[model samples]
Target: MELKTLSEIDIISASTSKINQVDFENLTFGNVFTDHMLVCDFENGAWQKPVIKPYEPFMIDPSAKVFHYGQAIFEGMKAYKDTHDDVWLFRPDENFHRFNKSASRMAMPEVPEDVFMGGLHKLLEIEKNWVKKGKGNTLYIRPFMIATGHGVIAAPSSEYRFMIILSPARAYYSGEVKVIIAEHFSRAANGGIGAAKAAGNYSAQFYPTKLANEKGFQQIIWTDDATHTKLEEAGTMNVFFRINDTLFTAPTSERILDGVTRKSVIELAKRENINVEVRSVLVDELIAAAKDGSLKEIFGAGTAAVINPIVGFSYKDTYYELPKIENSMALEIKEKLTNIQYKLAEDTFGWTVKI
Candidate 1:
C-alpha cells in the first residue's frame, strides 16, 4: 500500500474543549482522553488517507473480524511534558517497528510511517495541552488496529482500522507489589503470538491473574508454557531479578515481550558497571537465592509503570519476601528513565523524540 503524505491527512477539529473538567492531580489511568484522535481505514487493497478528528465513537458491524476472531494488535507508549512545556516521546520508533512486526504475525497490513508517526505528531500537536508537566504524569498513547470487515468467517478480515488515542494517566501502582509464580496457567505457548502486543495475549491472562489476586497476590510471574519452571515475565512488564548485585532477566523470544524499558535498564546498568544477564531465569535459582539471602530485588519494567518493584513473590506453597534494602536499583532506574523522559537530565542515549 502506498503511503499518504502529511498534506493528505484530513482534519476535523472538536467543537469544544474539555480541559477544564479534568483534575490533573487525580486522574484515573487511561480513563480520560484528549479532545481528538487519529483514525485510518484500510480497504480496497490499500490504506486510505489518515484522519484526525474529535474524540467520538463510531459504529462497526457486529460481524467485524476483531469482534469474532480477535484480529487486533496494539502498542503502548507515553508522551511527557517538561517543566518548559516541551513534549517528548520515548523511543517511538521502537513502538512503530514493533507494531508492524505484530501486524505481520497477525496477517494484517502494515501501517505506513506517515500514518503512524505522522498522525501521532499531528494529533499531539492538536492536544499538546493534555500532556501534564510533572513527575509521574504523562499522556498515555495507545495505537491499535482492529479487523473491521463486515463478514467474520473465522478468518482474517479484508478490512482493518488503525487508530491512535491519547489518555491522561498518573503514576501507576502506588505501593509495593506482591506476585505469584505461575506454575499452571500459561500466557503464551511455543510458536504463538505471545511476543506480539495482540489484545488476546493480555485478555488470556485475566482469569489467571484474577485467581492470583484471590490468593492475595497483585500479579503473576508467568513462566515457560511447556515447563513452567523458567520465569518469563510479570503482568504487563518484563520481569527482572537482582541476586547479589547481578541483574537477571529472561531473553525475549516468541513468548516474551521485548520491552523498551527493560532494554534501557540493562544498558543503564552496564553504564554503571553493573552486571546484567540476558538469559532464561529459572524459578529454582530464584528460590535458592532467596534461601541464601541473595535475592535482593525484583521489579517489572514497561512503558506504563516505568518501574514497578516487587516486594514479595510466592512459589509452590511458600512465599518469599524481598529485603528492604537501601538505595534500590529499581528506584534509581525509574528516576533515570523518568528524568530522561521529562527532559530533566541529559538524554545520553538519544531515546527521546521531541514533538
Candidate 2:
C-alpha cells in the first residue's frame, strides 16, 4: 500500500488553548486531553486524507457497527520530554505495528504507516507543550480505531475512523496494589481475541475486575482460560513473577498480549544480569514458591504503569503476602528504563526516537 505523506494531511487549529486552565500536577490518567487530535477515516475500500483538528466530540450513528458488533481497537503510548525541552517517543513503531495487528485480527482495515506515524508526528509537534519536562509527567498517546458504518449487522463495518488523542498523565497506579488470582473467570480463551487490543476484551473483564475491586483488590491476576492453572496476565498488562532469583513471565500467545514494556523489561533484566525465563508459571508452582519463601516479587509491566509492583496476591480461599525487600529488581529495572526514556542515561538499545 502506498503511504500518504505528511503534506497530504490537513491541519485545523483549535480556536483556543486549554493548557492555561489544565492543572498538570493534579492531572489524572487518560482524563484530561490536549487541545488537538489527529483523525483519519477509512471509506470506500481506501483510507481518506488524514486531518489534525480540535479535540472535540463528533457524531456517530447509534447503529454504528462499533455499538453492536464492537469492532474497535486501540493502542496506549506516551511521549516524554527531556531536560532540553525536546519531545521523544519510546518505541512508537512497536505500537503502530501492534495497532495494525489488532486491526487485522478484528477484520478491520490496516492503517498505513504514513497515516499512523506521519499523522502522529505532526499531531505531537503541534501539542509539544503538553509533554511536560519531568520524570513522572508525560503525555499519554491513545491511538484508536472504531467501526463507524451505520449498521447493526454482525459483519465487519465497511467504514472506520482512526484517531489519536493526547492526555497529560502523572501515574497510572498509586499506592501498593493487591490482586486476586482468578480461578473461575477467564480473561481469554485459547484462540480468542485476547492477544489483540480489542475493546471487547477489556469490556469483558470489567465485571470480574469490579468484583475483585469490591473485595479490596485493585486488580486480578488472570489465569489461563481452560484450566486456570497458569498465570497469564495481570489486569490490562503483561505480568511477571520473580521466584527466588529468576524472573518468569508467560510467553505471548493467542491468550496473552505481547506487550512492549514486557519485552523491554525482559531485555533490561538480562542486561542487568537478572535471570530471566520466558515461560508460564503454573498456579500450583507459584503457590508452592510462595509457601517456600521463593516468591520474592510480582510486577505488572505496560505503557501506563511501566512496572507496577504487586504487594500481594489472593488465590482461592487464602491470601498470600509477599515480604518487603530492599534493592528490588522491579524498581531497579524501572529506574534504568525511565532514565533511558527521559534521556538521563544513554539509550544503548535505541528505543527512544526524537520527535
Instruction: Write down the TM-score of every candidate.
Output: 0.98, 0.98
Return the lDDT, model 1, position 41: 99
**lDDT tens digits, residues 1-355, model 1?**
2222376799999999999999999887789999999999999989999999999999999889899899999999999999999899999988999999999999999999989988998899899999988898899999999999978478789999999999999977766689999999999989999889999999999999999989889889999989999999985999999999899999999999899899999998888888999988899999999999999999999988899999999999699999999979998888888899999999899899888
Instruction: Please give the distance, in angstroms, between residue 290's alpha carbon in candidate 1 and its true position after superposition.
Output: 0.9
lDDT of each: 0.91, 0.93
User: Any idea what lDDT model 1 has?
Assistant: 0.91
Which lDDT value does model 1 have at 291? 94
Best by TM-score: 2
Off by over 4 Å in 2: 1-5
User: What is the alpha-carbon lDDT for the whole of candidate 2?
Assistant: 0.93
- As a whole number from 0 to 100, the lDDT of residue 69 in candidate 1 is 90
lDDT of 2 by residue, 7-126 (tens): 798999999999999998897788999999999999999999999999999998999999999999999999999999999889988999999999999999999999998899899999
